[model samples]
Target: MSLRHAVLAALLSGEYSGYQLTKAFDVGVANFWYARPQQLYLELSKLESDGLISGREVVQQTRPNKRLFMVTDAGLAELARFAASVSKPSFIRDDLLVKVQAVDHVDVAPVIAQLDQRAAAAAAKVEILDKILRRFRGDLDEETYLRHGSPIGPYLTCLRGRLFEQEHHDWSVRAAALLRDRATRNGDPPPVSGQSR
Candidate 1:
């Protein structure tokens, strides 16, 4: 999805200044849709020009005036249309994945280091998502919140992110182990037809 849609969805929570929206993206939307603060600001300008969102200038005594943005009715309609439309299948285009695929022909040290780094990054994301989920749930218990709290879109997405990061971390660890083993056995005898490779 485009940054425009992401920005529109973010505005659904309420009005936010450019800086606040950037922080929102960093904390919440980073799990799924990644956008830099510059991209958000540029999209905000486009969204305003398209009449999908409106911006109001908020005067401040201590700082420069900031523009707070909110989604317009047109924006809501656009978002609804986007939701109804089928999305194209997403394909992985990760450099790490490419490296892993060609590990047999490359230095194992850097690949192993990348895997560890990725696992750590995934763990960090899991922590961030967990914190966001806790804040979203507030005083409500999990059962009560799931049954009768606010709409669970954000909660559900956060949960998905948490689980995905966990899987990524676990898988990375396993991949690193397998690669290490293969590296150690690089000159070992080839397996017989009936034996495991």
Candidate 2:
């Protein structure tokens, strides 16, 4: 999906300034789509120019004025059109997978290190996503929230992110352990922690 559609979807939550949008993307949208602050700003400008979003300047006494943006009617219509269109299938395109594919030929030390690092990173993301999911549900229990929550899109997406990260962590840890065991059986030296080579 285009960044435009993502931005429009984000704006559906409410009006947000550029800074707020960046934070929202970081926490909410990063799971499925990643866009830098500069890229978001650029997309916001483009959306505004296209009449898909509208922006207004808000004056702040303690700080410089900022522009708050919201999706326009056109934007909602565009999103509807996008939703009706058939989506292309998603595919994995990770470099780490490529390395793992060549693990038989390449040195196992670096691959094991990378897998360990990936496991740690994925675990951290799982924690963050758990907190976010909790916050999204508030006092409502998960079943209750899923049954009767307003605006469940973000919550659902965050749930997907959590699942993805949890699986990633599990797989990474498993792969690393298996490789370490194989290396030991073959009398290869243990990988030095945090060493790239």
TM-score of each: 0.89, 0.95
Q: Could you tally the backbone clashes for each prediction? A: 0, 0
Q: Show the lowest summed lDDT stretch of 10 residues, model 1.
A: 188-197
lDDT for each candidate structure = 0.84, 0.91
Q: Which one is best on lDDT?
A: 2
Question: Once superposed on the true structure, which residue ranges of model 2 sit more than 4 Å away at CA?
Answer: 192-197
lDDT of 2 by residue, 45-88 (tens): 99999999999999999999999999999999999999999999
Give me the displacement of residue 122 in model 2, in angstroms.
0.8
Which prediction has the highest TM-score against the true structure? 2
Clashing pairs in 2: none
Compute the lDDT for candidate 1: 0.84
TM-score, prediction 1: 0.89
